[model samples]
Target: MTTHLPDAAPTNWVDRHAPSALRPWLKLGRFDRPTGIWLLMLPGWQGIALAAAMESRWPDPLLMAAFFVGAALMRAAGCAYNDIVDRDFDAKVARTAARPIPAGQISVRQAWVFVVACAMISLAILLTMGPVAIGLGVASLALVAAYPFMKRITWWPQAWLGLTFNWGALLGYAAVTGRVDWPAILLYAAGVFWTLGYDTIYAVQDLEDDALAGVKSSALRLGDAAPKAVLGFYVTAFVLALAAAWVGGLGPLFLPPAALFGVHLSRQAARLDVRDGVAALALFKSNSLAGLLLVIAMTAGMWDGPASAL
Candidate 1:
């Protein structure tokens, strides 16, 4: 017999207001847990914000709007694809056993159709950007396609996810400026470590199940050192973000907010209890706020004037 988790927070709008017929599909796309959408969207925004700061102006409203839509669609598509690829593994993991696909709420064929629909919508948005951004968007599919398989081969699938998820930093900058630069590179690296940290926390929720199922994860690899590893990843991410800002020519006004962002990451590390799955999941979700803080810092940098003015 199959089981189904409620698939939404008790108070989530999807749970409370979505049409009954659509709920399962929406849940299959992870619309109920919006944190992943934010996490996926922010790197793109940060890249745009970084570019705008370097140019000493606000981000392009059109590009920002496009990214919001594209991020949502693409993130949904990515989740659908991941679920499709991991359905077998999902059944063996406690936290994931009740997911739509594994619980028989959605058929594999239906999920593929959903993935295709989402990708087509995202493709329409991508086509509006320059050739460089278009190319980057196409390239991202390779990462997305390979990601679900990483856990079967490596102890650090989260690292692969970091690389995949943070591709937005590069793509966003390219979309706005028609080229990738040092600042974009740095920002991409920063996002990678940020994902590494948060994803590791997320994996903590499945440590025992993963171990039993022979899945590999950073949480499993780090063992008792997971907290320290989280701190290390966070610190690296903070430093790289600062470097990206500096390279983008952000002024002194960027420092305070950036420091605050660092403090938030540090606090997450300090408070982490890897053994507590609830706490681990909460900390993972909190990175959504952490992402917003980075966005604020980057946006503040826009008006602070360029590095030469500092």
Candidate 2:
């Protein structure tokens, strides 16, 4: 009953290079679309970079590497869990119809096993961090578990995703500094709005499908006002991010990179066309670069040395 359903990205490695037996599993985990990995990792890097800037030091290489691995595992686990929950809905949506669960390549029980396996791997990685980071990791499970149901109850599931996705900002800071600070809080909030903006753009791709599926999304809620709503989300993210750097005392050098980051988001908002799914996806993916720019900005603040060091 396994069907060779279409992948979101036709040329992705899972489709092109993965062995047939493994493709279903890899696709289930979304390894075929690398954007989610980058999106998930950037916030962690931004957290590391922010903490490093605060200390006038380089980010810990091991910590950054761990975040990369952890994000990949956790994201996969999340996608599997989401798929299992949304299997019925996925069968109805063209974009998700070919997914492992919906296409009958994986049963709900098998997907649950995969989720547990991924979670265990991610937990092992989480345990390598400090007690504070470890606690944060455990706390994050609530958000992760609750996210799939958000769309069923609220019009702003993307908002819930915003809260869930960027938790690394707090966890990363705690990992580096062993505690939370105001700047870290601001950075986390900034990431929330950033997710809100980009995920809303991503939802544009499934507007009609989501409507037909009875799933609520910001895209459906905003209707023709989605473009303006995206602008508002992006603007709020930029302002909060600026405040985070300023409060962290990252120095004036943070301005240029931050400006560049804002500009990238601005361009996405400016060019967004809800009716154009291809363009919406492209704009959504561009946030990865926008996130990298913010990380660079945070890291660059250390170049002049911590203001205290100077």
Candidate 3:
């Protein structure tokens, strides 16, 4: 029996929503896939929550909203840029052949225009943040611009992704306090490792295709040891996240959620079959749940009082 790859609904939806001329560019940015947006937003929210825990205040709703909008636009822009750069490579992969650039639905020049439009929207959101947050946000553009080429040069493009994705942790704290601190750094590191583990699982689905295309990935690097590597990364992520919470003085309510996150990670590691692409894609999508669970844990930890705190 053959397993079908997960269909990208957003790509399809965007294609339907856009004009015939614009559909391809919109699809390139994956406006229809909201999971990437959520993944991007969570770390920023985590940072905001950690700051709230330290200050004994609720996380700022306005800041949260801004980060949410910023995340969506930036993620879309990133996708467009990636598709444009990887058009040839994406065409070669069965899973990505339908992408706008590879399908010749959009030109590279058109994609650049779309990227600029998205960046303008992202910039509008950034201007609302504090100077420190703004600086961090500005710095991320370099990472975003460079990411598409990392696969061609390094097997560890996921590490670069970790660096790019978790930047919100820094921005969130800076938005709240206008300064960088140890707690935010710890949370950022944890987010990086978490991304590393999940993205490695995602890469597993493309292992054979990636190998044939000469693409590098952590999944390819680990081979049979991928499961164990995932375990190690998750363990580190949990430990670092816990340490960040502790440093932020988050109460005991965090312990239960953290423990639950550990269980989830263990389940993922135990169930993973690196050689099974369909199974790998399922497992990769499951990380959205894992990430949300950890966010819940973090939120509870931040909300739970000192008396009931772990």
- Candidate 1 has its poorest 10 consecutive residues by lDDT at 1-10
Give the C-alpha miss distance for residue 70 in model 1, angstroms: 0.9
Task: Encode model 1's per-residue lDDT on 1-310: one tens digit a residue.
Answer: 1222333457988879999989888888889899989898889988988888778778888898899889889999999999999999999887778788999999999999999999999999999999999999999999999999999999999999999888988988998899999999999999999999999988887778888899999989998798999999999999999889888889877777788889988888887776787777778889888987887788788775666654
Flag the better candidate by lDDT, 2 or 3.
Answer: 2
RMSD of each: 2.8, 3.4, 2.4
* Displacement of the residue 55 alpha carbon in candidate 3, Å: 1.3
Report the lDDT tens digits of candidate 3 across residue range 1-310. 2233643743456656667766665567776666788888889988888887778777888888988889988998999888888988988888899887777777789889989999999998899888999999999999999999999999999989999999999999999999999989999999999989989988887887888999999989999899999999999999999888887778787788779888888888888888677777767777777777766766777665662255
Q: How much is 39 displaced in model 3, in angstroms?
A: 1.1
Q: Model 1 off-target regions past 4 Å?
A: 1-8, 308-310
Clash count, candidate 3: 3
TM-score for each candidate, following the candidate numbering: 0.95, 0.96, 0.92
Model 1, C-alpha of 103: deviation from truth (Å): 1.1
List pairs with backbone clashes in candidate 1.
none
* Tens digit of per-residue lDDT, candidate 2, span 58-127: 8998999999999999999999999998899989988899999999999899999999999999999999
Best by lDDT: 2
lDDT agreement with native, every candidate: 0.88, 0.90, 0.84
Which is better, 2 or 3, measured by TM-score?
Answer: 2
